[model samples]
Target: MKSKKILVWFRNDLRLHDNEMLVEAIAKSDDILPVYIFDPRNFQLTPQYTYRSGVIRAKFLLDSIADLRKSFQRLGGNLLVLTGYPEEILPVLVERYDIAEVYHHREVAHEETKVSADVEDCLWKLRINLRHFIGHTLYNKEDLPFPIKDIPDGFAQFKKKTERDAIVKACFLTPEVIAFVAIEEWGDLPAVEEIVSAEAMIGEVHQELIGGEEEGLKHLNALLEEGSTIYQKSTVKGATGKSGFSSRLSAWLALGCLSPRMVYWLVKDAEETFGTNPHFSQILLGLLWRDYFRFMFKKHGQHFFNDYAMKPERLFSEDREKLLFEEWKNGTTGNEYVDNYMAELNTSGFIPHAARLLLSTYLIYVLKIDWIKGAAYFEEKSIDYAPANNWCNWAIVAGGGKNTGTIKSAFDLDKQFKLLNLVVYKQ
Candidate 1:
């Protein structure tokens, strides 16, 4: 009998732990071929001419891919790194490797789904199956209280019902070993220079967060070690003095270096082992919000990306609008709090959740700039840029989504700064 072979297509879900697709492939296939494609489309510039995947984020992704490759090597397998469109490259790979099927995590955003569709079409022509798994969210979609269309638009409602009705599934255990198809060349991981232009690489790369499952697990453990006391205070001295506290696991979570289920369970265990803190519950709430955004994207389709949904009366001429946007992006807005946050984001590719909410609220309700443009800028720069979370959160801020009335007005910068007790840097 001919040996069965399956190709594991690594996308955002890069880690081995709690990976359903990887575990499934190993179970059903005689040999597995793991591949990560560096799609050129992802590395291009946004319409605003910002790096779609900026130097900091791109480098982090590369580091993640390299780390995953090392993991496969430890398992006596290899990850095939390729630079090209998956639709074109996958069919070729299927033919060469006699791959019986391709497996990957399903994505919800327009561009990502479009790519999946293209790959599915190409693979269909060759009579191959491209299986998709749901591994990104804390709660599995199948186990939700309501169908995707019926999910509550307001997060509080969604959270209330889902927390009552739904249960998070246990994580898939990591396989001890993987039998992989022998290949002549496992392609090289490209540097930031190769991925983006010199001008795109000019910004300060965030050195604090290194991408990889190993590093991500270490970070998770450290956060757990601090217990709920630090988390309860919910303020930390950051690179930018006195920023909001965070687990700082988003970059890993975004890249799939860390599993959402793994994080959820580990946190739950810690709560049980240590004493329960309201902040620990808040951490889980964050994950629930992540799920809500992803499912919202699936239900609403491209509506979140539509700018006309929240289009305001023209406040300035096109040129003036551009100038205002540039000032905001370059941290020259002259609002001390907003500029400080922007500078931190520009330098570190990160800012706390509260900081993001304040900045987005200021951009839309205060600056009177288009919220979609701000979202695009985030897509270009955020190291933790997950499409569903980033775009939908921006839409929510602009009051464009089903949960319009949920986000309170954040236009009063002085009041917010005082409430958070954040000190602004003076020039």
Candidate 2:
């Protein structure tokens, strides 16, 4: 019998450890082709800025793909890099190769969901079976107590239900690496300039962080030992607060270099070792918040894309919307504190979580612009950006995305200034 061939589609789940799809594929097949399609649409989607991706994020993605190639080679497999719509390219691969099935981690957001659907449709037309596994979060989607449609509206409720009544499952072990041809032969990784034009990155900084599974695991281990304990102190202490511990894992998790389930288990282990400490508990709270956003997104679905994920009917003025978006993106709307944080993110593909919430509320509620625009802007620039947390959190502060029907006035920057012990700003 001929060796069965399968294609492992790479997306957010970029690592080999505890990867359900890869394990299943290896169990079922003798040969596997690891494929990563840099869908042009991802870079083409224009968010609040004229360019869809900032240089920092773009550069980071380039580095990440490079890293994946190295890891795949170590594991005895190869990564195929292609630039185009997956729907269009997947079929071509199916015809050219003896593809028995297509395996990948499931995607849930509006855009990714649509892309997966498109890929499924095209593959079905070609008579290729597509297999999707759940591995991103600690809780598997099918195992959730409620269906995606019946998920609750608030994070507190979602967290309570999951915490009290449910469990965060264990991770699956990685499959043995299947040795194959080198990825460079499939297609060379694109240069930063090749992915987007120089004009697209005019004001955007070009410093992207390194990306890959090894880097992701290294980051995860670092957070457990040093990050959780000093999180509050570092953030509160300013410069020292930037402890590489803020788990800088967001970008990796977003890209699938790390799995949320693995993150949860690591945090739990850290707590077992040092949960009694106040600093460690504080760090655990942040991890819980990350899970909270994931739960909220599962419940809300694409409703997250609207101005107010919950209050789609409520509308903002056009002029206010345009001006606010410009100010937030440029980091120069005369609000020095807000500008400071925005400038940090614009220059470095990073911003602390506290700053993220503060600046988002400022842009949406205080500026009275459409929160969707702010979400879009962050999506473009943030290395760790996820649609659910980014968009739903925006709605929460903007006084939307809730079942409570309360649209509180946007956050008061003056109050935030006082809380941060910075010189207070007046209205």
**Cα lDDT computed for each candidate against the true fold:** 0.83, 0.70
Candidate 1 differs from the real structure by a C-alpha RMSD in angstroms, to one decimal, of 3.8
Q: Residue by residue across 128-170, what tens digits does model 1's lDDT show?
A: 9999998999998889989988988778888899999999999
Best by lDDT: 1
Candidate 2: segments with Cα more than 4 A from true spot: 45-49, 179-184, 204-208, 227-245, 282-288, 304-324, 404-427
132-231, model 2: which lDDT tens digit per residue? 8777676776666787777766556766786776777778886555745223467888887787757657774746457778887886787678745454
Q: What is the lDDT of residue 214 in candidate 2?
A: 83
